[model samples]
Target: MSQVLIESLSATIVDLPTIRPHKLAMHTMQQQTLVIIRVRCSDGVEGIGEATTIGGLAYGNESPESIKTNLDAHFAPLLVGQDAANINAAMLRLDKVIKGNTFAKSGVESALLDAQGKRLGLPVSELLGGRVRDSLEVAWTLASGDTARDIAEAEQMLDIRRHRIFKLKIGANPVDHDLKHVIAIKKALGERASVRVDVNQYWDESQALRACQVLGDNGIDLIEQPISRINRAGQVRLNQRSPAPIMADESIESVEDAFSLAAEGAASIFALKIAKNGGPRAVLRTAQIAEAAGIALYGGTMLEGAIGTLASAHAFITLKQLTWATELFGPLLLTEEIVTEPLLYRDFALHVPRTPGLGLSLDEERLARFARH
Candidate 1:
């Protein structure tokens, strides 16, 4: 048997329309752009993956254009001649040279894992290890920015049995105004749904100090990234003092950040994101750290499309426990899908497919239509 070498690597930028304008603290998302990654192997197998972000450079360092550019110029050259089956070696090679392109690396790593899984006739979950669960309970984000509208959306989702956990995007408006909005939605939904808030690092420590107390008292389930990621001491203080548990999102840019945050007791829950940690395997490293340190885990998303969502799902299914569940409702937020079949969401959970690789195939015509020329 001969070693199967990677023949080529390519990335395409696809712009997909969203169901609505997704309002975050930093920016409003009119649409989502995905950097679709494809890795061609000598054995004639091609694997697909996605690297997506929210609001261009608004969310993180890697924008869609930058991700595509780096994948083409830097990642492709290093991976083209490597052993396609040796994902560990391939990832290590990227790590040795790359500094902080976790978003780009995640897509490449997913493609490699997808390729390996396809070659071996196994699902990516089985390739990671064995899955403990075949489905994950997904949380929906209500970011319509209107209290009544957001409540209506939640009711519809609940009516359809699609979602019962709603996370509100706050911190964009005045603290009191945002508080009123969140509390109003919570009041309307009242015990029927688990309401949470992601401040998106908008609140300062002082504002969060009071806001966290109010949210916790009002029956909010969780508070995420209330203050800035740069204020380590403040995060530690808030974590220790807040009535509700604080979840680290932006603070964890890598696995090392997870370890450091754990050691410092900066947060009680960690938001596990594959793009932030480098890849599916790398994100698991962060999950292990959280598990070892007794910190809870919530599977987070960068609002990725189908390929990225399923890739994240495959990694998440292998976990022993996900204390805060997941927010893998990215696909549902999009008005269009580039995949042949959309992912199944039923009874408030996203079902993980047992099929090979990520259990998805690109709809080529759709992809071509959405791809940026």
Candidate 2:
């Protein structure tokens, strides 16, 4: 057995244009910015990772610029001479010095895992408790804001068998307006597709109280973070009464948050994101907590690019149960990808790679084209 020591760490920020404006309650996104991480090992292996946020700071605490700066000024320095194969130990080292830069830590941890996978000649999933499935059913977000356009887009996805589950981005508009938009799309798609809504925490308790019932009665499958994460009592009330299953996205940011939400009966479904929990391993710990407390799981995305998406997939594929599938169609939203071998999406699922590492290689040329100079 040989030790793979970390030689150098570098981060690149790339700007990618989305296929369309991704509208959320907090913000509207015309482009996605990512902090791509590169970890070079003494054993001559290089691994890739990504740190991305939706709508910049509007979605979470960490932004692309902040992630890049922290990685260089803080995290990378600590990691430069550490054991790349000892991911847990390396993460603990970073945690000792840094606080609450989950996205940055996630990127670093992902690169470490990727390097370990490549060195071991096994896929990242095998390293993360071994994968139970090879493919994951992915859900698409219908954020066009236009009812007609959203229905058309969902129909095309269904027609091509690329996606059968659709999530709608609501709460930016008036509650009645958003409900009308969702109802129209659901009626048009009918039994052809499953429709869900993510409010992004735009409603108050009273607003959500009305919206949840209306959405559920209209056949919506789920409602995500309708009210604020701080309003635990409101969340508990909504969870107890809403006909549709309540999913906590913004609320459950860590393992402690998960346990607290479970104890309070705040939500029935947990939207799991690696970056939110600091890394793949941390998110897995959160998932275990959810499973133990009888909470269902849905793999959530921070609208990450290829590197982060595949890192998430490698960990998620190893989960025991994914009741709500995953909303990992983040890369598909971008007009271009930084991966040499683009992810395979067909038959309503994203196929996992059997190759080593995160099962991805960087397309340097494409990355350069999108790189922020």
Count clashes in each candidate, considering only residues at least 3 apart in sequence or on different chains: 0, 0
Per-residue CA lDDT of model 2 for 239-343, tens digit only, reads: 999999999999977778988999889999999999999889889988998898999999999999888998999999999899999999999999988888889
Q: Which candidate number would show the highest TM-score if scored against the true structure?
A: 1
In candidate 1, what residue range of length 10 has the lowest lDDT sum?
47-56
Model 2, C-alpha of 178: deviation from truth (Å): 0.8
lDDT of 1 by residue, 125-147 (tens): 99999999999999999999899
Which residue runs does candidate 1 get wrong by more than 4 Å?
none
- After superposition, candidate 2 runs with Cα above 4 Å error: none
71: Cα error in model 1, Å: 0.9
